[model samples]
Target: MRGSFRRYTRWFIAWASLVALGGWLLPPLVNVERYRRRLKSELEQELGRPVDFGAVSVRLLPRPGFSIQNAAIGEAPGFGDEPFARIERIECDVRWRSLWQSRLSFDRLRLEHASFNLVRRPEGGWNLASLIGREAPARGGTAAGSPPADAGGPLRLESEGARLDFKIGADKKPFAVINVAARLDLDFTRGNVNFRLAGEPIRTDMSLPTPGRVELEGEWTPGEKLSGPLAATLRTEGALLYDWIPLLTGRNPDLYGVLDLQADLRGSIYSFQFEGRGTLRQLHRSELPPPADAMPATLYARGQFDARERGRVVVESADASFRDSILHSSGNVEQVFSAPQMDLVVAVEHSRLEDFFQLARRFASGAGAAGLSGRLDGLVTVRGPWREPRLGGFFKAQQPRFIAGGTTFPMSDLDLRVNETGIRLAPVRVMVAPRVELVAEAVFRPPAPPTMRSKQISAPSPPSAGEPHAFGLRGLQYDLALSAKAVPVSDLVRFSRSLGIRAAREVDAQGIATASFGLTGKVWPITPPAWHGQAELRGTRLFLPGLTEPLHLPHARLEISENRIVVDPVTAVIGTSVFTGRLEHQGGRSVPWTFNAHTSQLSLEQSALWFDVLGHRPPLPLLARIPGIRSLLEQRTAASSLFAGLNASGRFSVATLTYPSVTLTNVVASAAVSGRTVQLGVESFRAGGGRGAGDIRVDLTAS
Candidate 1:
């Protein structure tokens, strides 16, 4: 029995050896060429495109493996006329376990130098939908999909380790070009897949006509179904200021700056969070642009967005800082974003008004001094879509002061509101004097027909001297309602001086004086035309510096008509005397004004008082000669009053005050109407210059 068993074992060993030798020397019965053709056909059927393969080699090393050199796949149907992927070489591992998997399975698949194109349609769809359709079941239902009788087989899969070159955009009119040279590592596990790609500092060149170049570097790992974090950082250098300046002023701008940003992103489709910080430096105007001013040397901002739920995004926080040539501002903003609505709150500290004026100068519209400084607080709410944004906000400033056009004014407690129509400010308080306040309500809107042109009509017949009636008028018509209250008359004079109007200063005998009026007219550009209004003055004393002690007036009202200002029933006390006057604007470019003043019982002492108030004192020698002047001098008085109980009406034309070439048109003293001149006669005719008479005529059209 032992001998027989040995013989059988020996025969088995010999047979196995013979089989192995036959397998090795019998041309390796894999039919590699035939298999390659079969694989080519299968791939073509699966991809719906032609497949090309070269130099198929079969191997029997550690396991049965095959290599295909120079493999290429044609582009899918809607992809135009180019191959989809081209691989220099690919090696696949095939074994009994892989073959029994009921499908072509590979233990390992390696590829090199592969290229791909990604396209997006204008309607927001992609071309890769066909790739996902390939994995669906071939048969109908559970009964027909019954597991195969011999389903116990190893899972079949293939992974690639290749370098991919990718291009992005539509098939035609491609805009973005991205070149990626990376180590692509992918793994296909049972019911799950993991991929990791790392590239060496990818550079992107965008031709968007902006300022600079963009560069990026990062690694990405996409797990099954995009359930992982994706992050990247892109930087830009040499950004232009003009690219962003228009955002501030609603005008085209030219400027340059260096911009850099770093952003990080995390979360999935259900939620997302993005945080970033950026900076700009060396900002300046590109050229002679509208806001032809340079920006601050450096600007910086940091912000974050958080979306942990649907329908809402929260601006966790944001802060910005700027310091331009003449202005400086630093602030923070917090906002909430709902699909169709948005709300934000902003607060700024240490802001200067002068800087704002300088900015306005570029547009040829600025006020007061050029510099301003103060603190500001603001709140804004915005809703609706971007196409038609609705904006409303409130702004307030503390101790805001500015000097523009040569005047200095302090703004206290300024509150304003903005809407689509225009901006409105109520009770804007301006300090015109140490103890006086000017409160006003102002509205500014785009110039319309009524506001831009004056409406003028023929004037009605003039009323009698004592008749009280409204005047008729004609010409361009404008609606300008400005009411200034509780402002001292002296302050008004000072304010006028700041407006390039230099004239004799007016003194205030009363503690405070107030003038209130409304002016409406169609003023031609830089030219004054026919305007009508009513002005009321209330005060105890109206000081005309060139005359003497303040002229005491109980109250005064003026009726303004086209080319005329009528002061009716005017009563003023000047050293026990009363005077009245009517002034008129002689039509011309120089604003020539003529006045007819009548007075009764003027005293020398009163005249001296008026002259002193006019910012001048009587000459010492003259003071010594006149008895009245001497009496005032003995009392340390600086002025002498004129005493003459007389009714006189004099017409004088003062076209220009700087050089003051005065003209007396007519004078009637005590029933004597002098022609073309006024002659002043003292109580006695002994005074020098023979009554001081002169004839004069004013040429309003003189250059």
Candidate 2:
């Protein structure tokens, strides 16, 4: 019995040894092709989509592994065409035991090149939604739950070298590119995914297909639902502004700005905190289409944003300073975003208004050259889920000065409020002199249509004159009030001189004036139309030094019509000269204004004084103390207050201001307007000792 047991034991030992030797000599065994088919089947079942592969290979070396060449996972059609991301090649180093543990341990995943089409659907959904077997429900359906089962555990992927292309819309134009050759360290256990893309400069193209060199290093965690704090630094070079300019203005912008950006962001999906700084060097505008000139070089900006809540985003601070230029701005803004609602408040300190005007003139016309220097405070609010946003705000500027058309008007304070209706200005006080104060309140609407033209012309809205219900005008409505006290009219003349506007002569005079009116105008919807109420001007001690002698106009009541002006009983030293006039505007290449004025009971002495003050002095006699007046003052008599019924017709154009042409026909010293021309008969008058009277025909058109 002992011998038989020994034999059996020896046989068992020998068989066990043979089995151990067989395991040691053979490699780690794995059905790689079977695993690949299983993976494909599992992905199809999980994603509810077909999966295809160009080639599948398995390796049984140190550990079981597999590789797929040109693998494609199908996506929904309506979402986008190129939904399946085709990887050039994929090699994964995976641990088989870990797969049973509901985990994947991949030593590395070498992906050569791939393209992903990330599309934002018209209904505001994502194309990637179907990849995880999660389809967004129709409008009325209940919200979807968490991620679907069989979604496959986190993938521990480390890319060797790869290129990624992204497209949007139907055209499938490449909007973004990511040339990635990075070392990705992923730990599914800790829910940490850290990656660093380092190579011969990872590049991308956005907006204009211009290559932008970029470098990225970041860490992310998916199990934490991106809630874990993340740190990344991205460097981008050769970013162009002209590429995105067309988005702002339908036309291609002539802007040229290169970008050098550095960003540091750390945040979660719920709330984010970021601080970034970028420099724009060599900023220039080569050729603007119209109404815009080339701009100066400007330094970019640096700013920070922090969001603590879901709906609130705060601009911790931001600053943009100009280089070798006059513009400088630093501000802080806060924004609240809620469903169908948004509100923003901005406060700018040490803002230059002149620089602001320069920026504005690029898109608008009739913008005067006025520099602004002060603190700017503004608040804007938008409400509702409407297609067009409704906005309202209030902007205030302190101590703003305006320099336009040769005039300098220093405004003490300017405050404007914008509502659903239009823009209204608070009472503004202007300082023209030490004691002079000009207070004004106004509302300005935009110009009507037909004033501006674009490539596509739109029809104007029908007039509302016959179908008015409650509103006044369709576009803009305004009411203005202006008052002045102790203002020197001579200062107006001085201001005009600076504006290059011709002034007869400078005069020193003080007066108090007040006017109130209302204006209604349409925006540039179709045609520019405006209607203004009458304005009344009252002045006292208004002196005119341009005359041969100082003259005072105590009071004047002027009525202005569309094409006519009637001054009723003007209180003047000229024995109350009353005048009525009509003006006609001539359009086209020349801006000519035609006027006809009839005057009566005009004092010759006063008229002569005006001419002398205007610097249009007649020839002076050698023996006379007063220049040019020796012969004029010598005139005799009780008839000194001549019934000089003067009918004057003349046309004045801006081009003819330098060399004026004048023609006076059928002039009578004491006559009235009998026809188209003034019927005036010259009367004899002596200045000092000379007397002369003759029919004089003055030709004003002859230069």
Q: Name the best candidate (by lDDT).
A: 2
Clashes of 1: 44
Q: What C-alpha lDDT do the candidate models reach, one value each?
A: 0.45, 0.47
Q: RMSD to the native, candidate 1?
A: 17.7
Per-model tally of clashing residue pairs: 44, 39
Q: Candidate 1 lDDT, tens digit per residue, 1-703?
A: 9999999999999998887776466446666787876677644543445779888877655456677888887765665556666777766665456465654544445555555554444433334333311222324522221222232222222323333333333334323222333322222212122223332222123222433444443433333333334454545555554543343223343344556665555553224565666666554334433343444433333334433333455555555555522222222222332333445545544555444445434333223335555665565555444333444566666677645455677877667675444345555566666866655554433334435343332212121334212111112223333345555555666655555542312222342344443333332121233455555667656443234344667667666656566665455666666667664444543443445656533444335444443345552343332222223333222221111111234352221111123322223422122222234421221122233343434221211
Residue 358 displacement (Å), model 1 = 6.3
- The stretch of ten residues in a row with the least summed lDDT in candidate 1 is 638-647
Best by TM-score: 2
Give the residue spans of candidate 2 off by over 4 A: 1-83, 87-114, 119-192, 196-216, 224-229, 234-261, 268-271, 279-340, 348-366, 374-410, 417-423, 434-437, 444-489, 499-581, 586-703
Residue 312, model 1: Cα distance from true site in angstroms: 7.6
lDDT of 1 at 22: 62
Residue lDDT tens for model 2, 594-630 = 4544444344433443443234564223233221122
In angstroms, the error of model 2 at 526 is 16
Model 1 alpha-carbon drift over 4 Å, by segment: 1-118, 121-208, 223-228, 244-258, 267-272, 281-314, 323-341, 349-368, 404-408, 418-422, 435-438, 444-482, 485-493, 496-703
